[model samples]
Target: MTTTHATGTREEWLVARLKLLAVEKEFTRRGDELVQQRQALPWVRIDKAYRFDTEQGSVSLADLFRGRSQLLVYHFMFGPDYKAGCPSCSSIADGFDGIAVHLANHDVTLTAVSRAPLEKLLAYRQRMGWTFPWASSAGSDFNFDFNISFTEAQQRDGEVEYNYLRGRHAMDATPAPEPVVQFAANCGTDAQTYARDRPGMSAFVLEDGAVYHTYSTYARGVDGIWGMYQWLDRAPKGRNETGVWWKRHDEYARG
Candidate 1:
């Protein structure tokens, strides 16, 4: 078949591949350094009592660790008004169940936290057939404090800060993007309600009977862990995305 992409002899391809390998190795080394820097960030002691509702019942933030010394919380975007979890977050979470056990064995508890009620979260988890832990922060300041959830007042005043930036998300635009509207409708809510919640992750450590927030990342800062994206990035087409082209795993048409 004819192609627009560059074509080359085996020898030429090998030359390019070797050069790319060198760059990839450098990138890998840089990523390692960044990981160390991330771990070096100062941790803020968590004093305010934050609670979450889980299958086990209402539990303190510290309890979410499940006896682990480190806690990793994925701030899922399932708002109280949504009929189901956000499809994008659901896609990201499709990889969690496989990794949660490995994380637990490594002294880390991996869980998802959302603003949706516990019942809603549990029902959705059942539908997805996920075994990883999920906790609801409904009526709690956990999401807001992490800057992944915004208040109506904050939205009204254009004070929504995300990914360490203020008033910059495409969702905050006057005419919401078509993908945002589509995702919101898919979740059974309007764009504004859907945008009220955002996606991110946070890390915490339990030390000397106190929990400390170590790091939190929002927006694309989370791309590194979105499993599907990592694989797509290595594929021949390399994402090749024109627009929103994903759905909850089950929503895809089966052959």
Candidate 2:
């Protein structure tokens, strides 16, 4: 598709650009306000002794901070039954590993958690060339507690809360969307198993030798962390699209 716009004089273009700049500045101010509010939110103390299987061996939730004051957990959607992580989550993660080092240097640790067992997570992480820490919550209630992984019975019942809301799911339909089916196939699983897991991110802070859940965001709330989308939002076309047009970075190489 082609888009045509009216040609404008240099003065006219400058005037239009100045108008847009004002709006952009206001938006940045509001974004800063939201960040302050998020930081002011109360931190809930975490008491459950959740365990994770990491390359460094079994570790607890507090251990994830790795001597840092803060921890950021990306709930990567790789369920126990899937052969790989979700493609969409993989796309988000493509922009994360590079920033993890910067965060680590700033007294924060960033890592990904999934239910796909340590072995599978390691294999896929190797394929993706991701250097950041990733761990498996397999055989633990971590993902279930965080509402990122669901059970078979829950799938049949078709009511699982995500992002703090409960709604009818694709599992309730006779046929789910083609993309859901395709994503399942790509992960070597069916739609039901694939949909059983959702993507999320959580923040934690260590204080007084105790771990506290500072905040969490799921679904669209996680979008701001996607560096590519942040760039696309500034592009001329601005995320112009009619359908899914991305794949795992490694998948592009194979193609």
lDDT tens per residue, model 2, 1-255: 554966688999999999999999999999999999999999899899999999999999999999999999999999988998899999999988789889999999999999998999999999999888999999999888888888878767767877887765654354878888888899999997888898889999999989999899997899899878889998988999777777988777654
TM-score of candidate 2 on Cα atoms, chains taken together: 0.94
Q: How many residue pairs clash in each candidate?
A: 0, 0
Q: Write the per-residue lDDT of candidate 1 for residues 1-255, one digit (tens) a residue.
A: 799899999999999999999999999999999999999999999999998999899899999999999999999999999999999999999999889989999999999999999999999999999989999999899999889999888887889998898874789776889998999999999998999999999999999999999999988888988999999999988999999999999988999
Candidate 1 lDDT score relative to the true structure:
0.93
TM-score of predicted structure 1 = 0.98
Give TM-scores for every candidate, taking all chains together and pairing residue i with residue i.
0.98, 0.94
Worst 10 residues of 1 by lDDT: 165-174
How many clashing pairs does model 2 include? 0
Worst ten in a row by lDDT for model 2: 165-174
